[model samples]
Target chain A: MSEKPYVSVENISKWYPYKGDKLINHEKKFIKANDDINLSIQKGEILGVIGESGCGKSTLGKLLTRLETPTAGDCLINGVSTKELIKNDMKAFRRSVQIIFQNPFDTFTPRDTIEQILLRPLKNHNIGNSKEERRKLCIERLEEGGLVPGEDIMKRYPHELSGGQLQRISIIRAMLLDPEFIVADEPVSMLDVSVRAEIINMLLDLAKLHNTAVMFISHDIALTRYISDNIAVMYLGKVVEYGKADEVVNNPGHPYTKALISNCASIDPDDEREEISITGEPPTPLDPGPGCYFAPRCFMACEKCLKEYPDKKNLSDTHWITCMNAE
Target chain B: MKNNRLTIAAQAVKSNRQLMAGCIGVLALLVLMIAAPLISTEDPTIYGPDVLNGLGENGHILGTNHLGQDVYSMIIYGVRTSVKVAVISAMISGILGVLIGGAAGFLGGKVDVIISEIINVFMMLPTFFLILLIVALFGNSLTNVMIVIGITTWPGNAKLMRAQALSLRERVFVKSAEAMGETKRQILFKYIIPNGIFPVIANTTLGMANAILTEAGLSFLGLGDPSIISWGQMIYAGKQYITSAWWICAFSGIAIIIAVLIFYMLGDGLNKVMDPRYNKRRA
Candidate 1:
């Protein structure tokens, strides 16, 4: 990882209110999808955010891409705050940061063929001066994204292609604009496992080739570690641990992080030792109490851990943990 | 690739036998209707006892009306009036309904509420009675009939289109477009209207047949334009001589049935072609 960071997320939080019978009573409850998330991505580095379902990993990805703005605090792209950047340079910011969605089927409009999809971003950003040049550039980019020739795919509708091909096309579209930062939220999650590695490899190569900063969000810790230079582990809307992927995998500090790493069956099945198992689902984020969000799922939950939110503790020169026992 | 799409449409056309037969029958009738002015030797209104002459006349193939005018010519002239009013009015209703419904459905919220309220108010009135009152007050001209049908027919199409648009508005692609910074007009025209308004258009074409038939019924009840020699006018003319001459009314009824069947068939074929579910299931 480089010394200088390309993107800095400083104490960001996001909440979505529940709409139900509670509304009739004039009561509002919010889902704390992201809580005080602070992280940074170095220039030309891939930072992977790994977590369980409903753990706010996807929400944080959306916040980074400006699909959904943070409720509090701010993310700084380079040196300018995201809120200020949006006012003066919204188009540039959107062009600079692109996102790859999980479901490739919904990524493009059904009426559009592959060519139209590729041409849309190019035309929107005024990347190509003419149609012929745009067409050539699209084919070239598709080839770089591992789609051969590309015109055959261009003439076809999305329904005619397999999940893998569609996903590759989506990736090609994002890369076509040559964005500086990318937030790929489970880009390969919907595809078959047999083709997952190919996509991950392609993403890694593209990141290197384009020098794009990426925040890869996924539930699979092993996959994230495979492509990511840095890793951030989230639990119940809080980053429990983050650092170099290899370091976090080898010496996980937080109890929540330890369970997540161990839970991955791919990492040392024969090294079965006495393990920590926290039962039950995570607590509802609506009106979450002042304590470690992971406290409910931690075996080492103390009284103080239950009553007070733990301050982010530095674990190493590059790692930080929001756990009470990070020391 | 283009050939494949052609073959698909061809297959659809082949499979729908009823639609094909109806279309052929309507085509034959349309040609006959258009050719009536040239084919008929007698004027529709010129009176002569010799014209009522029966089925095997020297010139009148379909026989003649009570006024001794050729039923064939009267039916032909009626075709022009009935078709002109119905087609014009159906087109008017279709364009207006699609616009009103599509905008309301796509815009949603307060716009939806207001448009829906207007549609609801129109729908609550007895449609036939409204048509009758309008025709009664406006003096039953072909133009007045067209106006009445156009104004009354729109509410149903608008309501249907609004419902369709409302559902399409919730699709993920629409949300994705919003995230991508697509304008509202682009979304409406490109996505919402294209996907939502096809059924309304198909339904309107089918509804035209019904509109024409309804106008014929009103004319039979002495409510249609007295000057235009419509199919319903021939029926009303033959009503007094019901026992003596049944061909005038019977054959005119056939013309109306054939026209209606043709539209229904076209609507059915278009629906089968346009409906996404049918394509998905069959493919």
Candidate 2:
């Protein structure tokens, strides 16, 4: 890895205006979708982000891809802030970063054929010299996406293809630009279980061959562990735990991370272990009171946890936990 | 081989008996209009010696009016005039509506509010009276009538296109295009317009029918160009001699009714066939 991270997210936060009851004269509210998130990824690194729905995992992906602007802080690409890069060189910024959406079927224009969909990004970024050259490049990228005989699929429309086929085409479309960083937001969660492994493998292989950094967001802990070098666990729009993948999974420091690991479904029949299930939902993001957001649901909740939010406590050179009790 | 658009349209027309009937009627009328010179014995405006002649008199199949002009020939040629005016006017209005509505719906926010308010203002006023006022003030020439009718009839279609564009703007594919760094023009024309255009196309046929009716109404009210021989003008000319020449008014009225009905049926069939929801249901 190089001395400088390829993409760095520095204390970024995103909030949305929340409309309260019209009948009441209450103050305007805001939902803290992402709260002071900090992370970075080097070249050829895959950082897995695991969180339940509404935990701001997708919001973070949007922030990194510049699909949505951060309400506070900034994300740096190669040491330059994204806002500056966008203002100065928007086309370059777009070419450098791409996103793979969750729902493959909805990602493509229904009127466009597979060839048109794949050729668009290359054409937009002016990647190839001529139309004929771009056509060849598209075919090669589709093959890299594991879709054999790309020419046959090119003539077909989105409705004609299966979910898995469309998804592979989407991945190929993102890769056609030769982007530096990609944010795959639950890319395979919408596909069938049988096809999920194939897609994941193809994605990882492509990322490796391209030497591209990726932020793979998913709710599946086992899958994240298999593909990611490092994992960040999020709860209620906050990163409750951050560390190496195996360390976070095997030696979970935060209580929420431990509960998440135990919650992972196992197939072993003879193994007997006590499952730690957190009760009650995470508090609503609207105007959440001070202190730990997870204190209400944490089994080890204490007076200090309810009174003040815990700061990051480093356990090792690479592992960090945000819980005071964990130290 | 996969079915192309033309083949699918042909199949759609063939499958529905009412649509087939409507197509056949409109096709026959169109042929008659095109072959009017060959089929007519004499120019419709040329006066003859036989005045107020009954049907089949002096070889005039539909008889002669008070001016001794052949009513059958007049009706045949009037088809050409009516179609020309309706088509031109509908095209003008359709283009204008789609442009305004598509821009409003896709751009949204303040643009939407402004355009929508303008459309509402137009919609609230009586459209027919507005057309009449414009034509009356501009002098009722054929071109003036067509332009006035075209301009007055666009607000409704604009509202429809705007609604479609609004929904289409939110589709995931549009966002995907934006994320790919596509320009605003590319997204609007390539993605938004093509997807939201079916309703506009379907509405255009209805607009043509409405334009035909409006033109006929104007001609009946003596607001039509004096030089043109339209079905409405025929009825207006024959009304003074109604007791003696009922065929003149009745036949022209029938022609107008048939033309408008054919367009309405075409619009209805197009709405069903072109609708994606309908296609999904069939699939």
Candidate 3:
């Protein structure tokens, strides 16, 4: 890890008002999308966030990118608070950070051709002086993104291109501004298995080329482990475990993290490992009871685990787990 | 690129007989309107000594009205009036509705609520009567009539545009644009409007048809500008003399019907051609 973090998420929490039921209005309810998240990424480091579908992994990405303001605390980029930077200079903040969404099909405007989509960020940020220069830059970026003979694909609309092709274009769009920090929210989850590795490798290569810090968010733990330098395992809007990717994956400290890792299909033919399957589904985020959010579904739950939320226990200098019995 | 759209439109028009017929009728009327002055032997509004001249008599091909103005020339000039009013009112209303409603839908939140409330208020009132009252109070000038019609008829289009904008605003591309640090104006015009404009274009064609019909109705009620001679005005001028000079009312009424029908067909054709759902099925 670098001496100074490129991106810092400091106890940030995002709570959305729950308005599902109209009759019961006495107590204001909120869906705690992201609760007290604290993580950082060094320059050129990939921090993978692995979780279930509604674990607020995407929400944390949104917060880090400044797409959504945190309800409490703040996220800092290069030591400057995102909220303050956004208020002070939104364009500068935007140019500094970019996001790659999961759905490549939905990322580009239907009206815009691939060229137009790529040129938008360059034009907005005034990357190139002239239109020709911008066009050249776009073609160059497309080539770098593994699209050879870029001119052929330039005129094609989003619908004309395959999902994998569009995903490449999206990556090029994010890298267009030469953004320092990138929040890739399940960037390859929507892609086919055949093209997934290619896209991932391309993303990693591009991030390395730019020396860009990245937050790789995904539900696929194995995929996240392959690309990430460090990993944070989240459950019900809280990070249950945080450590080096290989360390955490090999020796998961938290019960939730252990179950999550075990759930991923292993590759070895002869290795037989019993999967740890938790029974009950994760509770709704709205008005979570006074306990660890995972306590309801945890196999190793006890009186203390069900009564109070656990604090972060340092298993090592770098590895931190938020379960009472993890240590 | 524009040629591609044109080709698609041509293909769509060729495939549909009603659209083809509508195009022919509209084109023929447009040609007549353009050639009105060159084609007419005498001024349409000029009064002559020979009043209520029958068809094909004394150089009056379609006969003269009660005031002895040639009905053929009047009908030709009436096309100009009706087309002008329809085009102007449609342009004004279409632009106004798209701007207000597109902004409301794209911006959403409080702006949507406020604009939606205004649209609701406009929709709740009897639009025709409100237009009549405004025109009466503002004085029945041609410009005033066009403006009133344009302003009064936007609520429906606005509501439609708002609905389009609302759905488009939720599109992932729109969110991506925002994430790219695009300004609201850029997102609205460059992204939202372009994608959401098809329905508005279809709505505008329909609105033009409505505007032409509304103008005719207003003119028939004697609220049209007297300086201008429209099909409705010609009908109003010849209504009392229906028993004596039947051609005066007959020809003008037929012209009005044909114009309205042509516009309706064009609007319907445009709706079918422009609808994305239809295009997807065709693809």
DockQ of each: 0.30, 0.63, 0.78
CAPRI-style docking class of model 2 based on DockQ: medium
Clashing pairs for predicted structure model 2, backbone only? none
Off-target runs (Cα >4 Å) in candidate 2 are A267-272, B14-18, B274-283
Which tens-of-lDDT digit does each residue in B1-283 have in candidate 2? 1577579778889866666766887798789888999988779989999899999999999999998999999999999989988889988888889889999999988999999999999889898898889988889999998888788878877988899899988777887787787877888898888888888887888888888899999999999999989999998889998998899999999999999998888878788777767667866
State chain A's TM-score for model 1.
0.95
TM-score of chain B of each: 0.87, 0.95, 0.95
How do the candidates rank by DockQ, highest first? 3, 2, 1
Q: Against the correct fold, how does model 1 do in TM-score?
A: 0.84
Please provide, for model 1 over B1-283, each residue's C-alpha lDDT reduced to its tens digit, 9 standing for 90 to 100. 6886789767777767765765676677677668877866678878877756788685787787756788877777777777777688888888889889989999987999999999999889888889999889879998888888888889888988888889888775665554454557877877787777778877887877877788888889899888878887778778887787889889888888877787778777767767778768876
> With candidate 1 superimposed using the best TM-score fit, by how many Å does residue A93's alpha carbon deviate from the native?
4.3
Give the Cα error of residue A86 in candidate 2, in Å: 2.6
- Write the number of the candidate with greater TM-score, choosing between 2 and 3: 3
Q: How many clashes show up in model 3?
A: 0
**Docking verdict class for candidate 3:** medium
Looking at model 2 chain A, which ten-residue stretch has the lowest summed lDDT? A19-28
| Model 3 per-residue lDDT tens digits across residues B1-283 | 6787699778999876777877898898889988989987889878987799998999889999878798988888889999999889988999999899999998888988999999999889898999899988989988988998889888888988888889988777887888899999998899878888777777787787788888888988999999998988888889999998899999988988888888788888878876667668877
